[model samples]
Target chain A: MADKVLIYSRFPKTMMTRFAEAFELLDTAGKPAHEVFPAEELAGVRAVLTAGGTPLGGAEMDRFPKLGAIVCYGTGYDGVDLKAAAARNIAVGHSPGANAASVADIAMTLMLAATRRILVADQYVRSGDWAASRQSPMMRPQAGMPSRRIGVYGMGEIGRKIAARCAAFESEVGYFSRSRHDLPYQYFPTLEAMADWCSVLMVAVRASAETNHVVNADILKRVGADGFIVNISRGSVIDEAALVAALTDGTIAGAGLDVYAREPHVPDALTALPNVVLSPHIGGHTLDSHVAMQNCVLANLTALFDGKPLPHDVRPEGKTA
Target chain B: MADKVLIYSRFPKTMMTRFAEAFELLDTAGKPAHEVFPAEELAGVRAVLTAGGTPLGGAEMDRFPKLGAIVCYGTGYDGVDLKAAAARNIAVGHSPGANAASVADIAMTLMLAATRRILVADQYVRSGDWAASRQSPMMRPQAGMPSRRIGVYGMGEIGRKIAARCAAFESEVGYFSRSRHDLPYQYFPTLEAMADWCSVLMVAVRASAETNHVVNADILKRVGADGFIVNISRGSVIDEAALVAALTDGTIAGAGLDVYAREPHVPDALTALPNVVLSPHIGGHTLDSHVAMQNCVLANLTALFDGKPLPHDVRPEGKTA
Candidate 1:
């Protein structure tokens, strides 16, 4: 019999095909663990696989006495009760930087789509507004990328990639991070200062208690009426209500979002707006990213099964929750 | 008093505001020259301003016997009868490379949007499909930009900018231009070879008789079903029927087009497809680009009125017709 692993969060069956081949997966399909498996079955579970944003706490860990590892599917592990896992002597592992390139690619996609008014232009051609020589407010010539200010909120892997791409387009790149790094981009003392200086604010900060709702109304005001905000990081970083109001009242020009405060439940107010470009939370959903993350997960899981330390362990500093 | 200048094409009044201040304009508003202005107005017109895509043949020049200078408003002079101007002892001037950066920006926007399926994702979010956790083919993981082959079909101003932008995204860049330059990108001898080698074909070639329909069925076949094409060059450079068929039959995965073979009259078959991202021919339409082009236009006209050589004269080789 194969070693069993519990699926702690909902994921598509296709994504689990390779994992299924390697182990007997106790798939709960996002249901309560007790409802899906007997206590004996749970007791035999030595490792659990989970999505990064699913809530997993010490209470859940205590239910499985044999539990030795918690593995995150992607770069983030914010929802894992890291402190509790550490206290329980369980090794936590995540695929760091596996999805950074894809996330950065989506950031540029959202920025360009929103800034170019591409959707509006598409409708113009499709609706015959362009053919009829109609005048639209959006048809007014937009400012090009040259000399446009792009401010990144973090200096992590994704933020660095975004800054590099923006710089290639001849945009001026700047950043506000917790600590200054040796990157080529200009550094700002605070997020407020960067927001005030940049035309486009790219939110790539990691999710933490301090970062929750950090980009509130005040930051939006600092971004100004002519500026744009693009968030590819956790939606919790932005106060959703404040962002909607800012977009409605023109406190900011527009927004491009991939993540929301709640997954799979975007507010109708946001979907109804013309000035926003919205996507489902899929910033890291590329094929290459998935493969890379799977390799890391495999490495971590193989280590645990062999009674060894996780080679891809989540750093101690990452144990926020 | 401002010098009399004939406006041979229709343009938005706002776009002409600055020029109106510099010239006494006899606006044809895209009507026949003879119908809009009398013989006296035509005879008095020494300089005519025109959009680069509007057809201006020698027959039209005969209508304005005293017309000494034909100034194109944008970078291209493909539609101007350059040989006729040369034969008539008339100077042709254009704003060369004024809109390269803006055009290149839109090129990247279209490439990223179409390749990433931004429109499909947008619809999935708006229709509550994402909220319902529905499966979409478009939601399947896509390839990231790293090491992806980007083949630019021309190495002109816009092409160079596109290559630079793609390089910043960490893609493998290549080109098939008329002549080789000292750029770091790989050079393919022909479009067919590049089409086979690259995953994304960026159409940035100059429009000419020799280049018309150069990217036909065979070229698109080499691009394969997983590939994409982005055209920012003139509409006549592509074979429209073949492109539509290829898109429908999955000969190629998708296309992002800013120009069409027929400008205002796109076929319904082409517009109804879900795989293409369409835009009006607004590649060079940006405030900064226009300002730069207008300054060139201002210089060309100023030199013409002063009986000096047009400072921005069209080179003899651009006389396509």
Candidate 2:
């Protein structure tokens, strides 16, 4: 029999074609993989391709008795049960750093859109308000990027890219990361210190159990009434409830958010607030990123079937399995 | 008599207070100087402070017989009749390069907004479409700033700033201007050739009779189906009707416009198109630019009154009068 593989994520037609050439494709996109396929149909499944939203726990892995590897479709693999996979001696692979540039671009997009109030300006021009009034409403004056201080919460690849872009606009760039790199930018040891020093605070940390709700009320308070915050990292990295309160009480000036605590479900309070710019989690939804990630998934799967080391294996905590 | 000055534009209270200390202020804001002010009121007007929109011609100058200078509020003085001012020996002063950074900021804002489809994304999230659909609408994939060619139409102060910012995003920057500069960017002698070579074409040329309708149907045709155009310069620099048709057909991908041919009157046809992002001539409407321009205006007026050479004098074409 042909080596069978289960696909638990939606992919473009081209990527599906590539998968078909290598294995017998069993698609369970937009549904729970365990529930979608019968026991007999999943019996010979040796590997699975999943997206970030699909939870692959011990229970799901138990279904595929011959399962050898699980490849995540995107850079983020938070939903994948790494500990469970490690215990089962099954390899876990993910496309790491594939969408860094795209996510950084979205971070800048949200920053500019929120600060410049582009949505409000577009509405003013489109609704005949500009024509009727013949004058732009006197809005709070926007401070441009030049000479302003920007504090990045995480200084990984994405954060570094964001800082580089901000620096080109003549912004003073600073960062807060767990350990300092050899970068020229000033490194703040704590999040609150970075918030206090910068006018615009950007969150770009990775999401893990330890990092959950890292940016809470205290950090927002330190950012204060004149500062802006932009979040392009995982939604769990920030305390959404604290953010809502900050925006409501004017503890911070404004925010640009791409991720939410709940997938596809944003709080009504955030939508109602005028001080926030919201976009569906689309930071890595570019064509270039998608193709790169697809290639990564293919590479991981090829390496696994050939009985070679996975190109992007995920480790449990501080140790590699 | 205190040196009488006619304020032909609406200025901030602070600017007006400063003007009051230097002249007998004749505030003609929101009213035509020739029609609203009688002969008696305009007789002793020794100078006029106006914006780019307020035309200062020989006829308006005739009302202010003692007018020694006309100080323009913003950088562009297209509305002011330079030849007429030269003929009447009325010195003209304007704030050159005052809003270059701000305008360049807006140019990048539009380019990113259009390419990323930010307005549509904002609408998608705000309307709860993401919650209902659970997936973003699979539109054409966005190719980001990195590895893209950006063609700047004019390489003045604003264009240079824009090029520097694009470079930071890893875009290959090119320019088309009447003459060459010492910059390292590739120079395209013709606009059509630049359009063909670039994915994003930014129009930043100053509007004059010679440069009116510079980006017409021919240029848009060369920009083709996958390209975007950004205009932070004067509206008349583009042929609006041609742009409307190109956007309707698939001749060009999209546009980010901050100006229109008619003040406060955006065409209904242009408004109906989903491909364009529009703002009401607010490229330089920032607090920083405003204060800088105000200081420039003040300096020019002070110099003229104190019998010093005009700091930012506008000489007539090919003649210094």
Of the candidates shown, which would achieve the greatest TM-score relative to the real structure?
1
**Alpha-carbon lDDT, every model:** 0.90, 0.84
List clashing residue pairs in candidate 2: none
TM-score of chain B of 2: 0.93
Model 2 chain B: which ten-residue window has the lowest total lDDT? B133-142
| lDDT per residue as tens, model 2, A1-321 | 677889877665565887798778899866777688899888888888887656679998898988899888877778788889889888888888788888898899899888888888887888898888644543446777774689998888899999999988877999999999998789998988898899889999877777899889998998888889899888899899999999999999899999999967899999898878887888887777877887888888889888887888766458753
Q: How well is each residue in B66-164 modelled by candidate 1, as lDDT tens digits? A: 888999998887788888988998889999889999999999999988988899998999999999988998778887788479999999999999999
For model 1, state the Cα shift of residue A174 in Å. Answer: 0.4
**Alpha-carbon TM-score of each model against the true structure:** 0.97, 0.94
**Model 1 lDDT at residue A42:** 95
